[model samples]
Target: MSRLTQAVVLLLFGGAILRASLTDLYLRYVKEGLRPFLIAAGVLLIAAALATLWYSLREGETPDDHHEHDAPASGAPGDDDGHGQGHHEPRVGWLLILPVLGLLLVAPPALGSFAAGQAGSVSAAPASDSDYPPLPPGDPAPVGLLDYASRALFDDGKSLTGRNLRLTGFITPASDGSPMLARIVLTCCAADGRPIKVGMTGKVPLEVPADAWVEVTGVYSPHRAKDPVNDVDVAYVEVTSWQEVPEPKQPYS
Candidate 1:
């Protein structure tokens, strides 16, 4: 690619990064902690692109003066059979436009039910101990899927015995066509995401579509079953109420 093309590409890429980082869109691909780094990188790229463009334009305006004062030596590395030939960039450099377009024009959505279905195992951290702290104070305390699973499996449902909990996640259908609430856990980015699932029973809407985000108020149920795909323990919840909700700003936890 020519220097002009390189500068343009850098500008577009940096703009796309800024656009995503300045809003919640970046959360779809990366964790929130990386926002500062992304913004800094975008700023640096834009500066570099502007500098390169300025230099290219200045050099273009004074090419004749430089050529008259400092001509290349004969048989130099860049000479082609006694004719001066500039370096040419490979065509592969153009492929970068694909990601630029993808980010700028149509940023991809967060991982959802499809990704949850394809994964064999749910990601859960080992319980630190058999005893867990009591649930926080709330009539319908908000809880994460992983936390509920840990308590259900390791603490024997003691902490969750009578507490009503509220969970927010997208619906992923289980093997028997029952809806299961799920949220993706990301260690770094979407590429490393894994789903944490909770089987939903009692009052689950039969017509809920897969991947629809919902908030369900339920109590932990001792009923547990091994995952069909990975044999890991899957927790259950007896949902008393549920309502479809918009997807959260941060889709992954």
Candidate 2:
């Protein structure tokens, strides 16, 4: 790339690092599909800056010649425009090291237990009708597990007991052979999250391991299950089909 283009690339890469460091939203939502691209762009920018710097230093100068006696005297010190060009090309590249190191050393800690405590699901109240949106015209409306949880809890599981729904989440283990539990990840913070789980009977794919992303289509129903002191009494959501998906870039709680 041209020296000007390389300079712009370095500047933009530095800006991305600064933006990701300064804003939680950028780290969470914006980087979901962008981690590999961002890293590749950073590498390209660094390489271009180094190449430009090398070219600036070597241009118009033979290996055997320093300052020839016949060469015209320069106007003054620092008068060669190209002399200091190498110095600035890398300034932006150097600026990117900070955030890179930060992520490598310590990925910003997961959205914590504290956040989950504060942001308990709105469906916590079973009598609230406002938790659900109007169902579309169909036998089953494919919805997020969070939506199912909110509506189920809103009506004390009355509205969802017989309705078919689809939800996506990662697997969590249960004593039964089938995946009886699942959790959706929230990137930035748990306050904005509502991970919904189900205790359903069916064959969970053996290949779909815990933490593996999966989309599950199922029917929501209320069935009694053993309640643990630590975990809440969960309603069984029957599974019809489960398919694994790629792990998202911004994995979260």
Candidate 3:
């Protein structure tokens, strides 16, 4: 890896970051809050590449004026050419191409069921005195999975009772074939994503394949179970109807 290769690698990596940020493709793997940082970092990397290119070119053009006196006292081990201008040869820098190719080509996907299984599942612990805000005005109120989980487990379903709520998320089936509608919440980025899941009871929703996004209309079941793993309550929803829906522009909550 020469300085030229280093610059090219930087250019590729930075281009991938800038492209992901500008095209809205980044939302799939990172939080929108990172937009500014991504842009700044990308621009800096691209600048480094351009600067390296300019230096390389300038170094190439002045060979006639070059002299052994220009060479540093101790040249690099292989550079017997005492004129002092040879690549530093950053062999390890080649490793940067792996992430560059990953981001540019596969563009890697958000973590899904497999990751959820490995991660410690989130469950809100039962709280007898938890206070919850009133559900916003709607017949079948639109609610988020995180909010619903908190209410169901801590507030004893006070906010959820008798209200048919609409919750949208992708499906992840349990090993026993029971389907769980799950939403991954990202605090900073997809690397830190965690799954909030609820078991759904409905013939139609169960039929939807894993990773298919859908909107579920349902009422929360009063009966909640204490999950031993996280010592948090796991809520259940009885779906009245469901339909496949386009994935939201920003999938993370």
Clash statistics: count for each candidate? 0, 0, 0
- lDDT per residue, candidate 2, 52-161, as tens digits? 65774567434223234233455654445675421122245455456545644544543422333333222223534555556555655666555566555446665666
For candidate 3, lDDT tens digit of each residue in 52-113? 86886777634222334344455457456556565343358578798888878875666776
Model 2 misses residue 141 by how many Å?
2.0
Predicted structure 3: clash tally: 0
In what order do the candidates fall by TM-score, top score first? 1, 3, 2
Error of 2 at 149 (Å): 2.1
What TM-score would every model get versus the actual structure? Answer: 0.86, 0.48, 0.80
Q: Which digits, one per residue and each the tens of the lDDT, describe model 1 over residues 1-253?
A: 6677778899999999999999988999999999999999999999999998798787773423434344456566654534446433347978999999999889688899999888754746556765687788898999888999888877878889888999999998887878888999988899999889999778896788999999999998888877777778898999999999999999998
- The candidate 3 region of ten consecutive residues with least summed lDDT is 61-70
lDDT of candidate model 2 versus the reference:
0.52
Model 1: lDDT to the true structure:
0.84
TM-score of 3: 0.80
Model 2 TM-score, all chains together = 0.48
Between candidates 1 and 2, the one scoring higher on lDDT is 1
